[model samples]
Target chain A: MNQPIAHASLAPATPFRTAADARRAIRSGAWTGHTVGLAPANVQGNLMILPADLAGDFLRFCQANPKPCPLLGVSEPGSRRLPALGLDLDLATDAPGYRVFEHGELTAEVPDLEAIWRDDFVTFVIGCSFSFEEALLAAGVPLRHVAEGRNVAMYTTAIPTTAAGPFHGPLVVSMRPMKAADAIRAIQITGRLPAVHGAPVHIGDPSLIGIADIAAPDFGDPVAILPDEMPVFWACGVTPQAVAMAAKPALCVTHAPGLMLITDLLNRDLAFV
Target chain B: MNQPIAHASLAPATPFRTAADARRAIRSGAWTGHTVGLAPANVQGNLMILPADLAGDFLRFCQANPKPCPLLGVSEPGSRRLPALGLDLDLATDAPGYRVFEHGELTAEVPDLEAIWRDDFVTFVIGCSFSFEEALLAAGVPLRHVAEGRNVAMYTTAIPTTAAGPFHGPLVVSMRPMKAADAIRAIQITGRLPAVHGAPVHIGDPSLIGIADIAAPDFGDPVAILPDEMPVFWACGVTPQAVAMAAKPALCVTHAPGLMLITDLLNRDLAFV
Candidate 1:
């Protein structure tokens, strides 16, 4: 059983105001946990590393399924740095925690990718929901899961991803219950930020998208939905991970859930409108 | 006992391509029916005419409740022309039909305001949902009522309007049943045209907004809501009329429902984004 390693002493005492500060702290081993509150003003990304041979199919998959796999930045094969995301970002070390997968199964969880960094590995930084979540909070839309300190309930939907080569699977969506008004507002707010999952894929009835159970999510803890609220679902970053695992890639690496790679891109800059 | 007088010979043989053309047809007695398909590319407005004594409060009410009463153009007291909407636009005779109200009660419906026009009457042209509906249809969002040749279903919600002087009443909303996905797309599409009601006020679970029965609408015709569809609601142009009626003004005039005042402004130009 590969469990995520947590370093108690590595947590930062103060939040980072800039992406560079957060990256430096992570690179120096001072911060080795989730990057949620570390850099409040920067974009955070879901990180995935695959072999050079599999990168093309994955890229095509992302193009075909933009809602689930919105590309933020991609690094050249074997490159440790992603200059577009951050000036001094180290792809191998900037992320707080990394998960190593072998033949679609979790093999090890480490603080950094230093031990098994592959020369043929290509780094893909995908957009995360944090940016839009921050926007939603700023707009006064409340998130029950965030308030309760629980992971957003995620479920595997029957909605199929546009297939590309061997990269294909059901789209996994993260659910947040909201009042009808707030849900409508959330749709508009997230619609402007297409880089971060854009708008919701489905709203209201769970059965419409093949989710047989609302209280039981396949991943993440289920938050109690109020009687006055309707469940709103967004295309999740987990889709690529789920699809990659299903493809049974020989070797794969991903940022652990909740732990992300902080980038220099401002969340506002990602809003196309 | 007065009712709208429709002249079969007054209906235009060919659809007008320009606002000027449509206004000319209406002005001349060549069009005396609904202005639904006339000047399809131009903006059409919900007409409201009130004496100078009530105009100020009505303006304030519109400002407070922009979703239901988006002001597109206004004419000064005693002025028959709204040059901003169109140089040739006549508030008195440009609309195909006008409804006269006295003490909040429907007194008479006429082809034009010529016989009842007063020097102190102030005309307010409000943005209509037709613009956003066209945009939605262009974007491939299907409208069931339009296909069935029936009026959009409307209801009076428990949502109260912000009162201004003597203007106050329950907020009236138009309901459109749509698949969750199409409803999401409608929100984004309408969000761009703020002048025309903007995004929907509520979505899913009509009872949450105090709509007890979705099938029995307070105004307009009710359409079938499919089992897989959710009822999406928007603040209706009928709201101002409802509010004004509740206020019981001495005299009020409005364009007959669906018989709008066509303007020179292109619908696309009204999109804020």
Candidate 2:
């Protein structure tokens, strides 16, 4: 799938007061595309919108499968404002892009969800990998995908998620190649942030987790796995989308992959003891 | 050296009362042997005594090398009580066994220090592995050393210790083998207890930490390392004693290998945010 499209760099004449100002610019049709490296150091969220009926099951699924679907905030039926994440936030337009799925089928990829917003829609703001990635980078952990400028490779593992009502599927995991020592440190650092898919699900041999082919993942782009490097897997935010699609919900909507809903909450504020 | 000589356990009828009662038994000719399975939940510590002149440097040494020498409580020169660790604690007689060193040379191993107590001596209580081991065992993490009835293999590694004052030497580490998943869990569990040797310093290939041979460790008996297991190494408290001996002070003292000083402080009290 094509990314939401990278946002245009600042036009050199834009005025900015806070994170909400940046979001306003993006929402005003002045900004378009992926939000990578833009307004970073803020907690970005993976978006999922579903009918109010399935909201309870999806919430349970997220609670059961915290490593993959760390819940940051959940909106009431038909609500748009996630004031906890942002003040001027409108899920329909604040995000850079959207993927509309009908009957678990990709129907369209667009810049905004305004035309498709339904009164019965309940929005879920799941934590993205950006916070942990920021932490890893701060700790000097070399991220192969970031260096190579590609999406982190993700795999559908044989590890089954705890079935919550109709929401059930194999856990999806994103892989990053790191040295063993760094992998250990990464586990400790990420463990501190349970809100962001805390700690790693698996490290070392991918075969142990039933990944038949590490070279070819089921999703995302594959990067080099060096001789001394181990493929450390984290429960990815994508797992919820995969689980939702597999269950064949009549209608579902999600953020275009990588085009997260940037929020005002600093990543550091999400730490748990 | 013959172990604490478990004569008490051979025909034991006495149920130990308090930590002080247990220490007094070990002090007076009532008991001598492994403290393990004795005071189940109490905090145990590795003991080190240095001359006042070199105590400042050793303090810096501990501050610099926190992983190996997580200093829990320190006593002033000529003072035997560490009120932070326990009530009415007398360092000279609290430990079951004491090793005396003269200018880096082993002079004697005794049950108590009453015969050699000096006015200028300063005592330090370093966090030991027993605290975390109890936690791991409580969590059902199989410990190969205790299972096989052997001492956890310890090695002097090429990983250098941060030196302060006259104490500078290679880091000494203790090895325990566990499956990859368990190793990750152990890291997370121990990482919460920094007062004890927090987390594994190095894992997987023992050679990464300069262990020439995994089968033969420099100290402690070697346990089985299963093929499915990774040898996780923790910064051992022995590193300071080894460094202290190497530094060769006029007179130094430490608790014998495994006979640690049991304190009234509970292990759970050591967990810090």
Candidate 3:
């Protein structure tokens, strides 16, 4: 099992009440760690920043693989503001941490994008599982990882993505073990929120999807599958990062794992129903 | 395995285009068989008629156990018309067949209630699984029983219904076997139609629900559960008949198994979502 990757900074003792407050704290260099429990009711998203020349192909890639890369908000070329997602949001400095990539490799981790900000960058905010997880938890669905305070277990699957341009790779999924009844209810609940990874991509036997070991995951920490529970798999937001890395663009940037961009949009609003 | 009870009449040569046409044929004595394929797009319901003295308790029982006995319409004591369910429906004669019960035992099966119709009898129309089954089939969820031309398997479960007065019995469930992905999709499809035995009551293991054998059902015909498929169970309209029999009402009437009351309400209109 992969242990959660530890970051340099520590999370603040008290969580911020609103997305603006949380983003303000992160912007002021007061909190530089993962935004796990911060602004609990707001939408927190994964970030993907690529040069304008490759933005159209990347947009097509996201449109094709919607389950893994549900586009929440997209910024204009060279723009720092995504007004639809957050009124006061600055695409460059709002996220707690950023991972800069060079030739498909992690080059450096920065607190903010001040030094690396480029005029040709286009920002894409993709929907994360946090939104649907909140809905599930609110509906009294027990989440083992949430109770254990660990990151969700994620794995690479034999399922292939509909390739667009150079962005082609195996689909990545996050797994949650649930009793059969809860799993059924989870499908109904998540099926309403197509904006947040939507419903699960696969359920039951992991081997059918080429997952050899339930105890081991390629990303995040693994949680035990209780005797009564079956592992439910959802398309992961990390797919964009993984695909970007494989594509080896000249310069690509993303929010570090668990270090997401908090948006003003209420999680409930994301549910179409 | 329980074989479906053989009725005296055969199904019509062709399905009726509308609920009105189907009910008209039944009322005029032109059709006296099962309504399975008739009025496919409309709602078909279970019938329960009891004395006015027992109607309140039966209504309460249905309200408490809505999943099994979803109330579609009710008639005033001795009134044969249920305008909301059908503009010209005559409750006493519109159904293809009726089962008359005396002291909890089936006394007779009759073509119509003309011989036993009483001034104090109240009619209760309960939603059936056929509506959700139609929705499921429309969504491309292949039902094994339908393909095999066998009745959907049904079992009496350890899961008990909430009692109201003397009305109480274990829940009766209808089973359909499907692959994990189809089962998940079926849950979502059925969850939308609460009026028609919405969603599944239980799934997976039959032993957990006190069902000792999957091959032998207490009601309906058995269909094979493929190795890749798990049995998905939904609350059956048969529960009201089971409860009514257990309660041992002095006099009770119900539609003969498979001979349901076709209603004017389209199955699509039943979806709350």
Candidate 1 backbone clash number: 1
Residue B42 Cα positional deviation in candidate 1, in Å, after optimal superposition: 1.2
Which 10-residue window in model 1 chain B sums to the lowest lDDT? B1-10
lDDT tens digits by residue: candidate 3, B1-273: 122332111222457878999999999999987888788788888899999999999999999999999999989999999999889999999999998888888889899999889999999999988788778888989887777777778898999999999999899898998887898899889988889888888778888788999999887788898887888999988788878888888999989888889999998889852
Ranking by TM-score: 1, 3, 2
Give residue A176's error in model 2 in angstroms: 1.8
**Model 2, which residues run further than 4 Å from truth?**
A1-17, B1-14
- For model 2 the local lDDT of residue A20 reads 79
| Count of clashes in candidate 3 | 0
Per-candidate TM-scores read: 0.95, 0.91, 0.94
Per-residue lDDT tens digits for candidate 2, residues A168-268, read: 98888889998777988998999889999998988877887889999897777788988777788998877888788877888889887667788888887
With a 3 Å backbone cut-off (N, CA, C), the pairs that clash in candidate 1 are B10-B30
Q: Give the C-alpha interface root-mean-square deviation per candidate.
A: 0.5, 1.5, 1.6
